[model samples]
Target: MSEWDSGKNDGKPGWNDQPAAVADASEGKQSRQDRKLIDKLVMSMQVEQRRSRRWGIFFKFLTFAYLFGIVLLFKFPLGQGLESATGGMHTAVIGVDGPIAADELASADNIVSSLRAAFKEPDAAAVILRINSPGGSPVQSGYVYDEIKRLRAEHPDKKVYAVISDIGASGAYYIASAADEIYANRASLVGSIGVVAGGFGFTEVMGKLGVERRLYTAGESKGFLDPFSAEKPEEVAFWQSVLENTHGQFIAAVQEGRGDRLADDPRVFSGLIWSGEQALELGLIDGLGSASYVARQIVGHESLVDYSRTRSPLRNLVDQLGVSVGHGVAQYVSEQRLELR
Candidate 1:
């Protein structure tokens, strides 16, 4: 760009005197045009420089956000919200833990993390899953259950029990079923042995609103779950088959976990929820006991320790901020930069 600039004079002296009037007049007009052109070019270059700076800042900000906000900041929460500092002793009580997402709950977020911290202690006699979840993902619940099974297998002497305070239906119960024994209050709603995927029927809504759904995909089932389109019969069948397969897996796991403890009946897998007392009759749950009773009986220590991450308002805000940013990136990537609504 600099080489293109003709030094603002194009090899001419500061001022010319020995020239004809016509030559001088033509020269002046040409010089004026040249100056205007130079001014416009300089202005364009400055605009481009600013644009480049903004792009640089954008990339830099995103880089910092991924490093500091997502990765490093994510771990800081775990350290900041330690169970020891929260005054939990003897028995560990793990709460809802996280959003119940698969990867987060199992590997990075909550469930396994709580169990790990609890079991790592030398004095931890018995670990309790103080579950209060309406349930979320089957994948996550299965992972949590398997992890507990693994942990229990590794430490065969230790007892892992689940005490549901409120709701422990579906996936929550799936994990709880793997416990050595399950306890819940009489009023707690337990069991919803099923899988469900939800979405809106925007086919009619979009039709009425003159909205066009432009979903591009490479696989047959790629856009099958698209909310904007009417579900095809084959797609519905495919999903139903998938749901049936996953539901079978859940049932098998429960059967293997609870053995003859769980009553053999259709209602168990009928997607029906029952009170804890009712579950006991059905053999879905073993007994009615709170965290206190479990600790006193199983752990032999009356004290408690909340191995689960109980975050403060400030800590929660940071966690949520990181979560929202990560979710945005994940959503963007999953949708391939497309959004339905």
Candidate 2:
């Protein structure tokens, strides 16, 4: 009561007597600043997210373009499928490159189709089989040889020539023998007229490792040449007889194809290879020339057109993507096969 009466410094405001309006105004300013900072942070995050999304879309498009380019390249290679468009007289070239097998690029089905196409084309002056291989399956080679002969018989006016490059031996030569005349470079290797069947015997290794082999078969000779089992002398002799029969068939085909042009040399069919020069002397080849030289000098046609069968674009894509790995592995592990190598 005494302090009130004194009025505490005559109307001056004390520390605990501050006005409420001033405090409310200060708090309102701070709240507005905090709201502005939060809004700015949210906007910045959205901008960063948009930038990342744009980059992702751009990279996706780039990847798609790359794959599309690859597909186009596989679909249309240089100098392929131009025979129909060219529509003029040219030397038809059928390529028999790599291993001659049922599943290979130089397969019987592919080579046969190519021959038919070349023969059917009216603009084709002559057919040339361009061979470059180490030789593989005898069956495939036989099929190609028979097809070539039938095609030649059908179109007697047109001739089929075989031009070997690098090394064309065994199954490759088998196919070449069917041609009207065969040619090769002077240094090229020619003629490995033989049949071969080979495998590894793992029985001793398994026995040493204490590994038991349990193979089930329906027939007695079904597992005759199995690698895990002991090889019997009788089985080996039978296998040899089969090979000899195949070799005889091969020799007969060569003799029939070459006729009197082939020389009576024992070493020609002794499963030995010879240089192209030596081959010409032995009558294995008609002349020393390349595909172009044969086409220009022999066929009298300079322009060349490829009629070889190739894989489809879709199949090529699948192979490039490694989709056929399992199938290839299964084939590799299936069985032993006979080859003309």
Candidate 3:
């Protein structure tokens, strides 16, 4: 090989342009380059993180501001037909449009609150309930009914009326009975004055499927109504008595509210729902009319104001999330056994 050629080195000092030293130097330079690239990547990641954090904060603030605005609107009544303290006469309408339960839209709290607000309004000539519900929890209906009675007694000059649109059965009818006058359309369903508790019997089904039912409770009668177990006669009698007492209370309330206007019909409190036309004959309802008709004819005020309390979007979203979680837990529980209360 030529002396200047560094292709193949002979066994000599300083041979092949110190190839070992040259390779070592190149490797050291590559190491430095790698460190620089790593540092650059780290800096880019930090910048991206900061940008993401800023956007997250912005959206959170936007959401909070939106919810705050809704709260303000609800509190201040931002031109949703709210009248001044000295404004002229107008009919105030509060809507009850769902099952009567603690957490439902037509709950006692919402209805009573709306009623109080409508009653407090100086320009309100009268208060009206626009009802469309299949009824629910008797306790919730009782609360609303009691409040209506109290509010009526407190403000005897201001009359409260119930106008049923679709279905006002059971607890809905219970609440409507407290009104000064109950009105329904010709086709509206009006009454189901009774108490009922029901559940399926799964003892035979479990036997057929060869599935075991396991239950643990501290009280002997705690699981009395378990579907997988045979029902005790004493427990059944106790439950029937409870239903009878509740039904008696319902009948008494109706009698007190309707007075002599109610026709002497045993079928009225027999858990049978009746059409508005049939209801009138039975004196379950006083008249046939819509909300508009009540506002114009009864209140003598054409302009109507709605005092219905409604859930905000954010609240509704939270409620939906809770319901989803509750459903999952309920399904898990139902798989174990069918419970009746």
Candidate 4:
């Protein structure tokens, strides 16, 4: 049979046989071209993978640099933050905000310690205390008040004044009254000559739920204010006496610090709060002004050295990152507490 009609499916012998010597070289060249194309494609993929890894490394370095910058923010000195263009005069600000808590004060581990160090600066013309608080522990507030008084007496020529940003009530006002001059915005809240103790009444709900409060105490009134138990009338009277005594002390402090400046108003100590404008007319503050205005107009400088433990970069970053999440958690907890019957 002719090779073309062969039963086996093999190619025809004439066509399938290796190329003649003349055309053999061309076949070999074609095979090599195919192999080269495949090799080139493989090499390109490898190069792209390496480039991608290089890009990843570059981004990692950039992240590290950003973290380093955050660190530098906390490590730098006070005067470093302010620009030099504010002129030759340099004023210092000691911000006492948040609560009258021991941690936030001018004590050993508090704002006061930071101020003590900052006030030591020779070039600072005046030290301004920026107070923004609703008041807290009377003892803590009194501690800060006494320190400011002592510092002013020591630094006679260097003016140490206060500028209440928003709310400076009760204990906060007690401290502010000690300042050489108190300044506040027209809308800033100024005074609340009062003391308060707060707690929830859960006795009715506990009865509804058949929740019996069991306790063993050596003292007769040990758990006096416990929510699960009905509060006694005598205990109520005793607590009222305590509040009245504390309120009296708060009133005396304000009167002593304000001296002849305060108006002769019997209702000033009736647990009432006043706005900054009303406070000024009542002689609680020397003037109505902001920190910047007070500095430029009175102290004559926009430059200020913050006498606070400038937060660390790591801490600041954590605060920035955690603020939203922390707030959400706190809000949820508060809502749950509010929902409880």
Which predicted model would earn the best lDDT? Answer: 2
Stretches > 4 Å off in candidate 2 = 1-81, 313-335
Error of 4 at 168 (Å): 1.8
Rank order (by lDDT, best first): 2, 3, 1, 4
Score candidate 2 by TM-score against the native: 0.78
* Candidates' C-alpha lDDT: 0.76, 0.89, 0.84, 0.73
What is the Cα root-mean-square deviation between model 4 and the actual structure? 7.5
TM-score of each: 0.67, 0.78, 0.73, 0.69
lDDT of 1: 0.76
Residues 61-101 of candidate 2 have per-residue lDDT tens digits of 98997788686766663224445447679999999999998
| Residue ranges of candidate 1 with Cα displaced over 4 Å | 1-76, 80-89, 102-109, 212-214, 318-341
Cα lDDT of candidate 3 equals 0.84
lDDT of 3 by residue, 150-230 (tens): 999999999999999999898899999999999999999989888877777888889899999999999988897788887
- What's the count of clashing pairs in each model shown? 3, 0, 0, 5
Can you write out model 1's per-residue Cα lDDT over 101-125, one digit (the tens) per residue?
Answer: 5434323257788788778876677
Give lDDT: candidate 2, residue 29.
Answer: 93
RMSD of each: 12.7, 5.3, 5.7, 7.5
Shift in Å, residue 168, candidate 1: 0.9
Write down the TM-score for model 3: 0.73
Lowest-scoring 10 consecutive residues by lDDT in candidate 2?
A: 76-85
